[model samples]
Target chain A: MLEDIVLGLGMIFTPENLFWAFFGVACGIVVGAIPGLSDTMAIVLFLPFTYYLSPIAGIALLMGLSKGGNFGGSIPAVLFNIPGTPQAMVTTFDGYPLAQKGLAGKALNTALLSSVIADACSDLILIFLAAPVAALALRIGPPEYTAIIFFSVVIIAVMAGNDPCMGILSVGLGLLLSTVGTDPHSGSPRFIFGFYELADGISLMPMVIGLLAFSEALRQAYGWLKRQAEGREEPPVHIPGNQGLRWQEFKQIAPTIARSTGIGACIGIIPGIGTTVGSYLSYLAAKKCSKNPERFGQGALEGIAASEAGNNAVNGPNLIPLVTLGIPGNLAAALVLGAFMMKGLIPGPTFMQNHAQLLYALFTLLFFSNLFTFILGKFLVRYAGTLGSIPETLLISMVFVFCVIGAYAANSSLFDVFLMFAFGLLGLALTALKFNLPTMLVAFFLGALLEGKVRQSLAISNGDFMIFFTRPVALVFISLALAMMVYTFAKGFSRRRHTMSH
Target chain B: MIRGKRLLGLGVLVFCLLLWFLIIPNQTEGKTGAEFPRLIVLFLAIPGAVLLLRSGAATGAAPLKGEELYALRRTALLLALVCVYMLVIPKLGFYTSSILGMAAFLYCLGVRTPLQIILTPLISVGLMYLGLGLGLSFRMPAGLLP
Candidate 1:
């Protein structure tokens, strides 16, 4: 192992590997900052380009892009209340509020610092603990998967909106929307509404771009116009003195970054449960552990640290299941697995013995990519701060156009554009109604997986519902979810009582 | 606000019923296909009921008026403009539709400066061409425009 590590380090320090890592990180930040584009899309786009390069250099490039994209997403989420990726939604809760308070620089830097820290920790874990962790991940069956997702949904619903009921309703609506298109078990169309495009159900790109980006543009436009009516000029986003994350601030959020990294790494090893859930669960856990939980959705630096660290930490560990079990943990990991297959390096039990040096080299490259993400992310923070100076009207108009392009480009379908517009309007309404839009979107993202797991668990049990309770891991998660819900209700009751007494 | 919340709850209940009785039967086949959706409908109805029961105690804020109303109208106009843009894109193509849409968006936002209006769309479209066209090589919709 020591010899392999040494050889791997030597292999990765080459000029070609270093250059591709740098280039990939640079492009990733740019691609990830855009609303409709994702790391997955970027990986797919650049996968062919990797064919011309050496295997290590090519894989290094993809790894760098994946890591850089993780942090790049927070730039938009912090600055504009628009998440560049679905998982970054958690960041927008406090990040955008911090930006509005003229602490965009501090928020961005906190996100970057935590991202790098958590990513490095997870990479170290991936390097040393892949086999054992992959074995643990294998023990998670459909019942356990369903329980975990259900627990996440319940926690998010209870914590998301001002009214817990509204959050649950939002989640329910999202789940219902997800139930559109074909029924997976029956192989029959459920709610196509006669549009053949609807056969695949809702595409995520349009839904996310519409809900976050386009709706945000509309909201900003309305606010700017309203301020114009009142003859008030909107203030610039970043205040000069409030721009940096002090060492003391970093010290404060270090524990949060650590805790969230743990959560993210644990979740990442399990296939299908994604970064969005990791970040949200971490955010909720952070809130639960904080001295003042109410400060979370406001301008809290700890919140940013928890979210960014949580999401970015998932990247390294997400590839573990792929490398050790030949099962991709998520879409990004699946794409990376594709890159592996392209290089004729099949990942499975025997893969380690066959290509130990090469695998270790790739793992070594992940650490270097983290360094690249930090340097490149610093430049992105500075650039995004300057963008805050652009006039609100012009910036929002451009964002709206970008949203349109992004939605359209996803499938080059006019129907998708229409879907984006519809969802944009729905977003506007939901915001006005005080529903938690992120909870809704996350629920939409996970609903299919949860449903499939639940149904599969039931099938395995011969339609017996006792399967969930009989399974120890599943029972533990279910109990935790119930405890959380009860606690939330009790807290709400006490708060209401205190208000009345006062 | 309370009224709206109540209405939202009622809407949820109504949809739950519609989905359970009408949409699920019409759209889905086989026994298992509708089972999961039925469970979800039940899940949705509980929150709807809870919202209805609890919202009566919630305080309401003053309704939109004056500048808020005007701002809403402006947003509506902007949405309508986007709708029009989407309709025209397949007919007039991405570049032409986007240029027209951008100009209209600026005008709607009360930016009457002719140079700003003309230049913003041109620059935006030009950048889009460079990025999506040349860089990513996406085949943007070229409708009737040569």
Candidate 2:
């Protein structure tokens, strides 16, 4: 291990590897800041270039892009309430609210700090715990996946809004929306309603951009018009908040960041769970554990910290399963696995033993990449304050055009653009009606996965529901879901009764 | 009487009924395909029914009033303009439609300054073209801009 580390340090510091790593991170941040584009897309676009480069340099480039892209989404989410990626949707909850209050710099900085710290810690875990974690991850199956999804949906719904029932209804709406495409099981249409565009199911980019970005534009435009009518037509200039994070503030949010990092790291080791769940689950945990939970959706710094940390932490360990067991954790990891295969490198149980020096080089590069992310993120945050100062009229209009482009870019389909507009309207209506839009969005994100897992489990069980209970991990998650549901509803009922008596 | 949560509840109920009776059978085949959706429908309906019954107790915030309603009309107008912009994209081309759409938005938002109006589209669309079309080589629709 010592020799491997020394050799790894030597290989990673080469000019070629260093330059490509920096370039990849730079490109990734730009690509990921766009609404429709994602890290996976960036990886795919750059994967061909890696074929010509040395193995270490190529892997460094991809890993750097993954790390940079993980944090890049928070920039837009902080400044505009528009999530560049779906996982960054959690960031928008508090980050945008902070931006509105002229704390854009603080929000961005908090995100950067937490992201780099969590990423470094998770990378260490990936280096040290890869083998054991991969072995444990293999034990997870359809039943466990289903149970986890159920727990996640219920927890998110219960904690999302004032009314747990309303939140559940929103989840239902999202789940229903998710079932719009052709059924994977029977090769029959479920609810396409004759729009062949939806045969592949509703694309995430269009739906997210419409709901988060476009609807925000409409809402802001309406606020501007209302101000005009009220004769208070002065558009307030958003001054940049104090960019320097105080030591006291850091100390306060440290535990939240640490907890979130753990959650993200654990989730990342498991294949197929993805970063979105890691971030959301961490956000929920932070909110639950907070002394002032009410501050979460209203621009808490810890909220940004938890979300950014959680998502970024997933970047490193997500590769653990891939390197240790040749199993990709999620799409980005799968793309990286593709890159490995393209290089004629097959990672499995004996991969580390065979490629000790190469593995160590990657690990060393991962640590340096975190430093690069920090320096680069600090540079990006410098300009974020200026973005906050842009006038609402211009900003709103520009955001609208960006949304159009983003929706169109996702599938290169004009149909998606129209779908985005429709979802925008739906978002507005839901928000006006007091539904938890975030809960709805999360459910929509997880809906297909949940359905697929449940069906698989049921198939294995031959139509028996006991399969979920028979597995210990699945049983634990199911029990938690049931307990949470009961607790939340009972609390809600008591609150309603108190309100009625008053 | 059927406003706010109650209205939402009724909509949910109607939708669930439609799914159960008409949509599911028409859209899906076999028990395996339909069962998950059926479960989701129940998941939605139960809460929806409870919402319908307890809507008075849950009575969300008050409805939009006077100025808020007037503002909503303007917002709706802007949305209509966006719809028009969408229709024109394939016809007038992506860049042209984007510039026009942005200009319309600025006009609707009361930006009368020519520099801001012109520069907004030029900069936004130029950056978009440079990044997406040039940098990434995305094929933007070429309606008329040869």
Candidate 3:
């Protein structure tokens, strides 16, 4: 372990790895500052670049992107009431209102500080917890691993937000997509749709680029066109005063930040829930526990702190499941998993046994990446005001170009570009129809893992369905999923009833 | 809104039933040991769809406002621009395609200045090339010019 830590430290300190880490963070910040792009989309757009990099460098880049993106997302939420990432949705509850009050700088500072602090805490937890978790996981066979994946997917389905049915459909679609390539087990072509490119299956990069990045660009363009037609001018960019972090503000929000970070880290460690949900949940918890819950959406510092901390905390522990079990916690981690495979590093139970030094190096890199964000985020946030001032029309078009380029670059295929557009249309249609895209995206992300695990579990049980229930861990997860689903439905029903009564 | 919800619900229900009948059965046959778990998906999807449909019908009763329709139109225009960008990028080269795309977008957004048009497109294209080419090491398509 000592040797591994030493190796880890050495890997991170290297000039090349350090350069990539810094570069990734900067790029992530830029992407996050842009109104439509999220951290996941940014990471996905950049995944192809990592193909040429070493495993440490690649991991470092992604870690930095995740860290920086989390903070960067708050910029738009604070400035224009637009969230760059779903996680940033909570930020807009207070951030934009604070900006309106000429406290944009203060809001940005608090968010950046909270994010860096939360990310650092989460990384510390990951550094300590990952090794032990991997060690324990090494003892588990295929059946156990399979059960864990199933449990994670089920949890994701239940918690994907607002629409469990849409989530299920999304999972089904994701599973169907995952099956398009050559079957890993049987090597049989399941649903290639007579396309040779699909023989290897649809690349996740293009699909993500299209759905998140391009679709968003399209949405923005529509707004731009509408504004033109209605002769509505872009709102003047307001520069706020220095009104940076005050002692009184800090005193109020510090406890909230700490508590939210803890909550965010715990939620992040769980697979499938992702950062967005973590942020919203933390925001709710903070609001509920606050001395002034009514102040939440009216420019409360605690609100921004809780939301930013919650989302940023997800950076470290989201990698926990992926590194320890080779099970990706979300789509970004799934891309990282792809990177690991590309680097000839299998990231499962045996990962530690085979690559302890590298794993430790990854942990160290993750730690340093957060530190980098802590230092750089302050400087970046000072200039974050400029982000809101960029001409929306130009920015929107540029994003569209990037989305196209990103999709085409993924496989160097025009068909993938077309596929992206098709998915964009599907996404837009779904949004118009009021179907929940997050649930669908989450479901799709989990579907393959669910399928693989369930099949493996059944194979171990000799086709017995009772194995899922018999295992204590699996049963606990399933029960939790069921409970959450029931609770969500009940809450929705009561809310509806109350609304009707009112 | 309620009608829309009901329609969506009915669509999901029908879709699930079709999958169960048409897709699942065909895949299930002649597959010996440990077939991929379809039951969980079916269990979740079928009932979930029904529930959603019912809930949607119960909730989606709000009439669409003018603002909502306007927002929808805006969204559609944005989608159209994206489609054009995708189609044009490969044929026109990154710089030309991006500049043209940016100009069109600016025009759509009510930028009428010729200088603004010229400057925005040129600066956008140059910076993009510099960023992607020199900084990120991505080889943006250099279409026509060798």
Candidate 4:
């Protein structure tokens, strides 16, 4: 193990690996800082580019993107009222308020510091603890994986919104959508209608881009036009100065960062509870433990630290499932998994045995990527004002073109452009009907994994329902999921009763 | 909004029922293979549809406010512009189509300046062409203009 660590360090220090690491970090930061663009999209867009790079370099690039993008999202959350990623949404609770109070620089500084610190802590945890976790994960059979995914679905549905029914509906819809492609085992067309392109299933990138980016663009356009029509002018944003972090402030928030990072690392290691949940859970935890919880949503530095740290910590452990189990923990990791396969490298039990040096090199690159983010963040903070000041009209127009081009470039299919538009309209209508798109999208993302695992489990059991119950690990996950559902409903019922009583 | 929700509920309910009848039977063979879990989705969709309808009926129809109407109309216009852009891009080539599309979008978004009308589109098309075409080495269609 010591030799492996030493070899990893040596491999990471090579000029080629270091340069790729730096490049990945830089690109990740830029993508993450931009509103409506996600780390997943950034990785998906660049997956084609990885075809020419070495396996270590390619994985290193993706690791840098994942780590840097997590922290970069905080920039927009702190400076603008907008969150660049869903994980950044928790940061906006206090970050936007701090910016409004002209403490943008301080808020950003705290966010950056906490992000880097939590990231480093999580990576160290991963380096030392991954083997044990992987060994445990290796014992997980198909039934266990199915149970974990089921638990994830339940958590996401319950936490999605005030309406659990709608959330479940969204998940069902997502599952249906996932079935559109050709069946993997039987080679039978499932839901392709008549189009050959649909045989491949709806491309994940286009669906995600349509649901998230295009829908948001439409929403922003409506808001922009309404403001213009009302003759409302946004006040010129005030740039805040660096009132360098005071020791007193650090003393107040350091514990929050530490706690949040721990929570994030745990959640990230789990397959289904993603960065968004991690950020929100950390924010809630910080608020609960704060001396003055009342100051929580109003520019509290602790809030920023908790959210940023929580989100950034997800970068390290999110890779655990992928590198150890050959299963991607999320969409971005799925794309990275795809790149690994493209490079003729499969990730699983024997992966470490065969590619120990590359794995070490990837870990080393991840550490360097965090360092790079800290360095680049200093310069980006100074220029953060430029990002927010871009004219909304121009930005929207540009994004519109990119959407068209991106859709076209995906498969060079005109039919895909139409499919993209159709999904965009579906997304718009769903939003109008008050459905939660994030929950729906996440469910769609997890649908195949859930289905595949369940089917495999059933195959192994020869139609025995008790397979899920017989396994202790699977039983625990099932019980947890049931508990979560019961708790969510109880909370909802009590809240409604309280409202009615009042 | 209530009417909209009701309409959506009906649409989804009908779609679900149709799928339940049409799709599930076809999938029955794969059932012994991977079928039972899908029943969860099917059962959930029925109740989901019911919940949607019940919620819609519980809330009386309310006319959209002026602000809401305006926002919806603006969104419709944006969608229309995108549709036109997609329709024209194949014929007019990437550069011209993108410039025209961008200009229309900016105009719809209330950027009325003469300079903006000319410069924004040009800059947008040029930058995208250079970035994707030259820098990324991804090709855009030339279309009618070659």
Query: Among all windows of ten consecutive residues in candidate 2 chain A, which has the lowest summed lDDT?
Result: A233-242
Candidate 2, which segments miss by more than 4 Å at Cα? A1-115, A122-131, A228-369, A380-385, A470-472, B1-3, B55-67
Tell me how far the alpha carbon of residue B85 in candidate 4 is from the true structure, in angstroms, after superposition.
1.6
Candidate 1 lDDT, tens digit per residue, A1-502? Answer: 7787898788887898998998888877776775445565556456545655788988988887887778878877887677877789999999989888877788888988999999999999888887565456556888987887787678667766457777778778878888888889878788888977888788766776677667877887898889888888543344323366778988899999999999999988765567988899999999999998999999888899999989888887887766775655665675576567657777755676678788899998888898999888887777764544556677667777777777776577878888988888889988988877766765775677678888999899988879999999999999998787767766765776686677
Query: Residue A474's C-alpha lDDT in candidate 4?
Result: 95
Clashing pairs in 4: none
**Chain B TM-score in candidate 3, rounded to 2 decimals?**
0.72
Name the 10 consecutive residues with the lowest summed lDDT in model 1 chain A.
Answer: A233-242
In order of TM-score, best first, we have 3, 4, 1, 2
> How do the residues A26-94 of candidate 2 rate in per-residue lDDT, one tens digit apiece?
767765665445565566456545656789998889888888888877777887677767789999999
Q: What is the full ranking by DockQ, best candidate first?
A: 1, 2, 4, 3
Candidate 3 stretches greater than 4 Å from native: A80-84, A92-103, A231-238, A243-253, A280-300, A341-346, A486-502, B24-29, B32-34, B40-44, B47-49, B52-95, B134-143
- Which structure among the candidates has the greatest TM-score? 3
Superposition TM-score, candidate 2 onto the true structure: 0.71
The candidates score, on chain A by TM-score, as follows 0.64, 0.61, 0.89, 0.84
Q: In candidate 1, which residue ranges exceed 4 Å CA deviation? A: A1-115, A122-131, A236-369, A377-385, B55-58
On the 0 to 100 scale, the lDDT of residue A442 in model 3 is 47
Residue A176 Cα positional deviation in candidate 2, in Å, after optimal superposition:
2.0
Q: Candidate 3, residue B11: CA error in Å? A: 2.3
Q: Over the true interface residues, superposed, what is the Cα RMSD of model 1?
A: 2.3
Query: Among these predicted structures, which one has the highest DockQ?
Result: 1
Provide the TM-score of chain B versus the true chain B for each model in turn.
0.89, 0.84, 0.72, 0.74
